[model samples]
Target: MRMRHVWMTAGTLFAGLGGHLQASDWNMPVGVTDVSREVYSLHMTIFWICVIIGVVVFGAMFYSLFRYRHSQGAKAAKFHEHTTVEVIWTALPLLILVGMAVPATATLKKMYDASDADLDVMVTGQQWRWHYSYLGEDVDFTSNLATPREQISGESEKGENYLLEVDEPLVLPVGKKVRLLLTADDVIHSWWVPELAVKQDAVPGFVNENWVRINEPGIYRGQCAELCGKDHGFMPVVVEAVEQEQFDTWLAERKAAAAQEAQGVDREWTMDELMERGEQVYGSICASCHQADGSGLPPAFPALAGNQALLDEPERHLDTVVNGVSGTAMPAFRTTLNPVEIAAVITYERNAWGNETGEVTQPADIADMLSE
Candidate 1:
């Protein structure tokens, strides 16, 4: 009865461990793209090969241990060397490795073939956002984290998408070869989307190439797989794969919107219009480093809520916004933002959060500064 109890306890312990192991099983995700699926297949093939090797080796070991035991009255056979066993062991492992390398080489060849891509999109990684430019399409935009501050700060319950959502997703057409020309504005950031089996490093001053062809239409989410800065984790990548017709429609709409915004550069924007637009631009671009209320995370992101220097010197403020502070996280808005957007955000910063400068910077003022 005591022996039975001991065995039962041992079995229970092992069973619990097995359950935990099962719960934490390492299963490679089978992605929606052909290359992703192929990668997964290769992974499984290698995994199973190792598993089979382990089973055969360990099986023989345990069988020899039990069968050749002294308790079984077995006699030991002594030998100096066995050439057949040695040769078999070496040759077998070499053949197995060669077999594994062949398929792996072919897969790599397929992955690197980015020629004859149907579309080209320039992906520029910034501090905590992604800037996408549709080459030859006259469409460009910056995608920011759309998740609210309240949810991130635990003031409210998390949403279904949570940190995975972005203001604008990288839209692509299904079954089309889309080549990405990746680069970074500041530091190194890796643009990775697992479902597409595309992970390329965006190094500053160097452009890396990667391509993907999606088989299915769906929303795929990924994050910056590089340590960039303070808000590295906040930079998420979202891709929306749709049919060719839908993608074309989206492209056209985006181009039209871009044209309208370009026209706004010549017009004089009112205080109310600038304020409203500035609020939106600030929330998306600036709020990640600076707090939502403009009470920035100090020592890194200085507070704009009651910044006396910013309010007193308007020219200095405009210069700072257009040509960013060197050796710091503040990015220049000259290239990333249009004249209107830069003007509005600056005007908003001066007036909002109880500073109440009541200053309205027109787009023409920004255009003049940029031209200078």
Candidate 2:
């Protein structure tokens, strides 16, 4: 009779939680990949096992406390050396663990095998941005958070994808095994996209490999799972998976754009043109440190507004940006940015805010300096 009562109480407890457990938003998403689905299955399997165990334990405790109260003259009953009960308790948990481990091990093995990938992407983590390079494709770009400052500051209403949106999303094709080689340029960071079931640490000087083959065409969003810097929350990852034909067209267009940018290095640039491009590049890359108003956070990032000394030496400004100061937090942008970007940003900084130098620094001059 007691055993039946305990079981009934356990069932009731578990039934109360069933509704929440079935909620899609409450549980792990059955993601857009085969591996992700397997992971979700494993998660639910273990979760239910844990829920059952908790229900049984708590229900028995509650039943005993109510039915065997001291006021009712109920005495504590103790027993020992019962091999049947001992074996049931011991073997039950062991069997459950083993059952959970089997599927988990299989999924982990599949996740680790990143060989013979159709596409290889080198994902580099920086201060608060992600730089993705399509190996052998001669295409690489940085992805920065695209959420407006107004939205963040509570001055304007937030958009649907406020913090998760980016200026450039890492584009990939569905039905292709795209292997990611992740590493950090500075501190340790993690590239995590839950839908793809790929979470790998991006450690400096160490390459971690993970692969994903999206089964759907959609935009998947994620963020850096590691505490990288002050702007850690600002760093977001967006992947747009499209059809093979669409991906091919996008890649070709990117290639053509890159070639055109290379050609720009040999031509003379106008002040207006440089300022426009420079303002954009500055906003994405330099605005974080130097600030949008050119008033940098001093002691670390010195002010760039109304700084006559820096504005006077155009050559020093160029070299400082290219090579970077050895003992400073500023990393060199020579490799990170192209000649056109470099010249345009420098021109923009010199002319922006209260420091209008009116100098037209051509991409050709920046390219020549880089070659030397």
Candidate 3:
């Protein structure tokens, strides 16, 4: 009995972790899209079907138990087989399943039809962050957790959206069909937004497509549905839908900024600039594993504060960053990061967290190496 109780407790905790339920929130969200509504409709339909089945089956079962109780001197009516009863039960269930499958299949077909989209965006999942790149628009940026370390560590009060907040929210135009191409770098990740009814796996080397057409313009939050790594719970997805004009304006600004950053590749960067840029990059891209202070969660993620191998072998460090070590957690950043960001982060790592090597790897040098 004690062991059974322990198993039940464990099962409940695991179910909660799987995002199936909370004390207050048990039902699936009725999202802000047409397909979302269809999904909700289907969910409720199946749910009520199950409920009715349980009621009828249990009602008959308890009725039999009470009505034909041996304690009440009720004799067992021995019956071999009833073809009519068997046929009715089987036919009813088959009909119910066919009824359920029709709507589910229709919803799935609609969800998969990501054709003739107004915009196309590539969503790449990194260790614990999301990178959004607009196809042909030349607008892309990494979105990281915006919650402060103090809040995570219990040093300060947690905000309302603590883990749900991100440094950048994916902006889409309301009433416009935005097609999302999902893929991951290291492991399998699921891009899930409850309100949008978008939960798709980002399998490495495989691009899974899904689309969303938001009926309302508002902010929607979600998290990595897959258990990618240790910081899986911290990976939040925030999408902000706005007017078409507003999205266009945002895209223009992003494109202009991209152009300016692209031009920075030829210029010589000072230590201050590199360090500043590197800190931000590291905090978003590398800090999840290496930590905020360079003191990594070792064995899996070694400490970089005074690592002799990294300090002594600059060429090896650059190679390791650009071309990741095979059969390890490190991913090649050649495609993930641009030349400028690569140089800035490398230079910053050499100098930050009491590991003052005074090494300044310029953007030009990094670009040249990348070309080679």
Candidate 4:
């Protein structure tokens, strides 16, 4: 009765665990793409193959243990390895491995074939953000994590998306082969979107390519699969797949806005305007490292809030921002940011956090500095 109860308890425990796993979805998602589904199939096939092998091998061992027990007066028969048995075991495993490899190889071949893509997008990974340039579309933008600071600091309730949301998502047209040329600006990072079954490394000074075609129109989110830096966990990738018409419309709107922004490159701006725009730019680009409050997490990221050097030397600050300090995490913003953006962010940094520099560096000033 005790043995039976023990068995019953073990069975109950396994049953409960199985139920919990099922509820929590302890399995890869059946993604909405052909390659994703194929990958899922491959994963399940290998898993089931392992399960079957385990069951057969363990079943025979357990049966032998029970049947050959000394308590039952069974004599142990010691024998050397039989050639036939050895050959059978080895051949079976080899055949199983070959079978698994064939499909995996085919899937890999399909993944590598990024030819005849409908669109090409250059994806550049920074310390904690993604810069996307739509090749042949005249659209470019930096996608940053949009999750509020309060939620991240545990001061406010987390949203449904939480760390998975971004200010600007990579938008793609459904049923189109979108090829991504991945590279990094500073360190090695990974561009991963599981629903599309595309995960490629973004290494500095080198480019890697991957393609994906979304079968459905929806929002899919992922994170940086590689550890880049302190804020690696904060970088998220959001993809919004839409119809071709909708995608074209979005592209047109983006191009129009880009043109309008370019017009302001030579125009002078007020301090209030610079500060307002700078606040937005700073939050998106600078906040991840120096923090939202300018009280940086040193000794890596130095505090920008009350730095005496920054308050005193305005030209030095501009030079540093344009041409970053060597052997540090600071990246040169000359190519990344336009004159207006650089001016605004510089002004904001000097004036914000009660430093009260009362500086209003304009785009013309930045342009002049760039020329020299």
What lDDT would candidate 4 get against the real structure? 0.91
Runs off by more than 4 Å, candidate 4: 1-24
Candidate 1, residues 12-99: lDDT per residue as tens digits?
A: 9856754554335356467888889888789878876897799689989998999899999999889999999999999999999999
Q: Could you tell me the lDDT of residue 152 within candidate 2?
A: 85
> How well does each candidate superpose onto the true structure, as a TM-score?
0.89, 0.92, 0.91, 0.92
Model 1 lDDT-worst window of ten? 17-26
**Tens-digit per-residue lDDT, 1-372, candidate 3:** 998998799778755654553223677888999999999888877886896799689989998999989999999879999999999999999999999999999999999999999899999998888989999987888888999889999999999999999999999999999999999989999999999999999999999999999999999999999999898998899999999999989989989988998899999899999999999889888888889899998898888899999999999999999999888788898987888999999998999988889999999999899888
Task: Give a tens-digit lDDT track for model 2, residues 52-89.
Answer: 78868998999899999999999987875899989999
- Cα TM-score of candidate 4: 0.92
Write down the lDDT of every candidate, Cα atoms only: 0.90, 0.91, 0.91, 0.91
**lDDT of predicted model 2:** 0.91
Model 3 spans with C-alpha error above 4 angstroms = 1-24
Question: What's the C-alpha lDDT at position 172 in model 4?
Answer: 97
